[model samples]
Target: MQRWERRLSDAAHALTNCGETYFEPDLFRRNVNQFLTIIRTVTFLIAKDKANIPDYEKWLSSAIGKYWSGDEVMLWAKESRNYIEKEGDLELFSSLSVALVYSYFTENDASIEIGRSELLSGGIKKLMRLAEAELPHGVSAAAAVKIERRWVANTLPNYELLQSMIYVYSRYRQACADLAEYLGIILSTTIPTAESIGEGEVHQRRVSYVKFSDKASYSKLTHRVEIDRTITPPIWLKDVDRTRPNFEVYAEMAERTFLHFGNHLAMVFVFSENGTILQHLAFTPFDQVDKFIFWRDLAERILYLRAESLIFVSESWVRKDPGLLTPIAQAEILGEMLHVHEIKRTGEVSHKAWDIERVGDQVSLAINDNDSLEASGFPNYLVPIREAFTRIHKR
Candidate 1:
């Protein structure tokens, strides 16, 4: 219990500090169910004291949200559950607290952003209020002197209690995940923490869950499972088709994408079927071949996902093996260098299109007469043969 209590404190602190939040609508609602389950089981020792319970219970319902059916409180267990279950938001409000409820039913970008804000502060705070109100040591001190039917008071362990509580809460959280169906497909990736990155150590990890939803749900979900000492986690999945031209896909997507507009750090938005506007920083150039391959493979994996795919990757991980995923934008970033590598490796050039301008045995790039480039620029684009040369030879 102490472990859970401390974690609950940690969660509260994190929430207060981080103003933003995200919640899968389904996951939010199922938790509400768990909350209700707890409330229903809390029986009173005194019948007269039960009278005051109705007023507090009614306040609990209304305080959580006006969305709930604002009606009189009933003590009957079966009837209480039945009425709540019939309510809206996928019947999420019936079991879960109103604070945790976010108004998300349709699958879209705007809806998610709005719901996330609510979940972070309003939802979490409300949940805390509910817990404190019911518990004997709660902030409001709402629970009366009568013995609780649901909670049996006993002398708890004095030492090493927090460790056991943590284990219990983890299972409870896992159980919540097991019992409730997450609304959309989750695409996740673990990015490296700054200090350990590029130092040859997997010293830190952070996972991003890109929840995708269509008319229905996807069968498999890969989550970022965290542990005590491990810094890097795992990536979601991989892209099987390696033969496709990655840049052509980018070139063709010119109409749908822009470099500067919208969520500019748009690498995360690659999984959306609708094109994304990426930030320039997201295109950060990498000289290390492995890191370049990793970033490119992440793009490839998301490109292949038909359902909402949650991606997970770390500093130590490129989404797939170097050869398995095609590097699109990554290629463009080092197109000339890669072209040179290919020529050096195979003793021939695969791309017959790029007008080659060689500077003393090293080949540079001249833009082809492709319509996309001709329209976008002043034309006559030149790329260096090797970035290591530290020189740009212009004609």
Candidate 2:
């Protein structure tokens, strides 16, 4: 690869992998310095090649005046490289702590912003609380903890390490493009913009599951119903024709899907007559409003797609006092079936299912609540767990 090509590849690789080793301070520091070195090398190579120009000094002054002089980020990038090479690893202060959970189901028992030094000293176990932002609402406690870390350099405290590196990399890459364009030389590869490579924090979110004593029951709580979004289109669907519909084949596929996701939370699969999946929506939302919007949109999409058969399965929280699922806005849809299972905090389960069908161009909702209640006891750990986490957070 050419110099510009190699730099782009390295920067892209660095940004993509930075999150993997972000918490390891030494590895992170070395990565940061290596990225800074890329900036320096790019600058040095551009300056060295100026000897080829007839009025090299004039061009150099013009380029600096145009790109570097006024840009604080570019100026910082230049100085940061020099500083790190002479002064050892970049000075970084990092901390990993749990961001407190706030949801409709759980009360905000703890409301404290942990200081950086304290958070670092506390460690993952010490900072774990009753719940986390990533966990769905209504579980007695968080099944997974979201451990957040921010790496800030001593010199640049305002912006975290990832953001600072992105800005620096972007500024230098732009300079390379501009210099090449000015010299009328065609580069080997297209330069990618910062946003395309990732402009924000290098590592976005990291979730680690907290093991509980009742492993089987807690597994159900943590198990989110989802179709792997990363999946490519299945080969079987490739031959299905949208113009000609086959409702029978589609219905079979929908039944298989229901069996797969029946135990978990939210899911909707809409299929056309020829067995092609028009849309498969499966996301577990923690907020009530988002859940409402998700179902409402599902209903709208079914109508829009003119789906032959659709399966909608959802899990809901039931109020122990009322023995009823908590009120959430519902959207009426003409579908094969709507199955809703409810779980109370105390580990009791009840269900209300409806057979939704189209009769003479009108939709009918026939409700059935004959399903037996499941008495699988919920783990008796909330009180002790909450107390333990509260004590940790306080300390």
Candidate 3:
């Protein structure tokens, strides 16, 4: 077995054994059913026209039958439903489902290989095109409602419709994987120790690269880039009293240092010497409000753009409010940047600054730095940020 396969198998074994302690039989069945569903969906998408799909479905049904109607599946489904209702995020449910499906494929190489073959089949492409055609175009909200009404009047939950949706979603997931791979490559090249940072630190220092494109004045468009990084102080520094002469002097020193280099992306490397990166996040730019809306509906579009190599840095000011997702103002700027970058591929990198809440009363500020690098078809520029923590007492 390949290394990835072995890792997946080990994970499955661990999960199975753990389930055995609390509720063995039911949990086992539910897991098995989930695996079967993934295989069924992937294999079904592989067939050229639906000729061989029935056989695959039959096999999946049998496999699922062994686990379906089990208490574990019911319990998990209930929990999933509760999460969906509480969060009011359909994307969460879709993400969970996709993760489960991918887990199954990871465990079985033969099944995934077959599914890959089917995915590349011409029949699947035609099905994708048909589904795309069904989606509404530029029209008034009332007109869209009318179109949806007409669609619902004729549409039925038939096997063909289900199959087509599965195909499209599967393609989308594949595209995400491709984008991740490309980004990984670029990060590797640009950031020397991109993969060396531990996962824990990476999570703590999560930074997002949001790209923006312009809809109006497409010819004069440009890229808006932003960088978000986490910062923590050293233990010794934290131990010192905030009012102490040395402590106050050092605090001001650090703030000044941070602000002085805030506009420079190159400063991250220098800062890394003092701390670590928790996460490196990046996404493609959106062209307009409608495009942003579409992306919100299909989270996979972020991956699609990455795969196409149409990504740029977003300006810092656009992400001033850290909690919000895809701010409208930022989207507009990003759209313009995306448009301009597409044409020229080089320009002055814009920078901005913002602050993030830290563990105590102290706050950490980050400067959004920007740089335009030639596309090397890989993620060579992603430097993994390191985390540094310090404790500070109120004086």
Candidate 4:
């Protein structure tokens, strides 16, 4: 590789290393400074290569004007490197933020703010108590919680260090590409993909408590909680190894709010397209305290995913029973413009069902299924429900 290419590769390597070292504060700080220095070196190499290329000074000056001139982010990157080399290591602000995930929380809720030093020193044990004290009226601890540790440049406090670094890396990558094109030099080394750079936000952790657990079990679980408290984060779920298949499925289900009517159901699956199951949720029955949670979460997920079809495997009682009717209505309102297929279940078999759908301007749930799910273009949806019923009968 040429001198300019080598400098560009070094900058990329520094960025890759910077992302991996967020958990190690000292190393992370060093990597950021190295990344900044390498970025500056890329342009410096271009300036020195002027003898080989025509009008080197004019082209380099114009390129700088086009890329880095008047750009605050790029200017900051240059200044940060100068500060590190001349004065000292770049100063950074580190912080830890704790967010409690409860069904009752609305948009008005705010996450608890804790200093990095306080959390790292010995604040992990206080998480539960801190969370409970600020919980709203009648609310205890969260069903799930998210904790994030972030670092930002003390000068540019608006952007997290990773985000700022990613932005600067992308800018420099473009500048280098333009310079190479101008010099008619073909790069042998491939640039990093957009997805790799976009993953800069994954600096957090998550922990969830079991639903409907007794106080003793909850307290015991809380006492054993340990936060590495490093400058790092995740979605809400129990203390399960994410590498495990079951935990992956559980996390996806929690994120998607995949649901089923009864606890006895063997599996609850959400399909995206072509019968591919997006999520296979555990059919855990909600008690009285959290029954509303399931419907609300499910509705929110439906809206978020912009899902068009919904096949609900529900017992016959859910339709005629007054107590079960409210949640169904809530689902309809929140999940508007949805084509709903309600498969009514009897003792051992599912009967005909109804199709609730949008009509012109308004949405309606009308009884319309004259045949079984197998005949209604939804044979795949019926398979799991039948399998669950088969298992229950065998028991």
Q: Top model by TM-score, which number?
A: 4
Question: Residue-wise lDDT of candidate 2 within 267-311, one digit each (tens)?
Answer: 555554445555556777654433323443343333223344444
The models' CA-based lDDT, in order, is 0.24, 0.47, 0.26, 0.51
Give, for candidate 2, the lowest lDDT window spanning 10 residues: 212-221
Instruction: Tell me each candidate's TM-score.
Output: 0.19, 0.40, 0.20, 0.46
Q: How close is candidate 3 to the true structure, as a TM-score?
A: 0.20
Candidate 2 to truth, TM: 0.40
For model 1, what is the alpha-carbon lDDT of residue 314?
A: 12
Ranking by lDDT: 4, 2, 3, 1
Count the clashes in each prediction: 21, 2, 45, 5
RMSD of each: 26.0, 15.6, 21.9, 17.2
Show the lowest summed lDDT stretch of 10 residues, model 3: 144-153
Error of 3 at 109 (Å): 38
Candidate 1: where is the Cα deviation over 4 Å?
1-271, 274-281, 285-293, 296-395
lDDT of 1 by residue, 18-136 (tens): 11111233443344334334333322211223343345455334322231132112222224344556752222111111221111111111211123323433543444455445433
Model 4, TM vs. native: 0.46
- Give the lDDT of residue 324 in candidate 4: 26
Q: Between 2 and 4, whose lDDT is larger?
A: 4
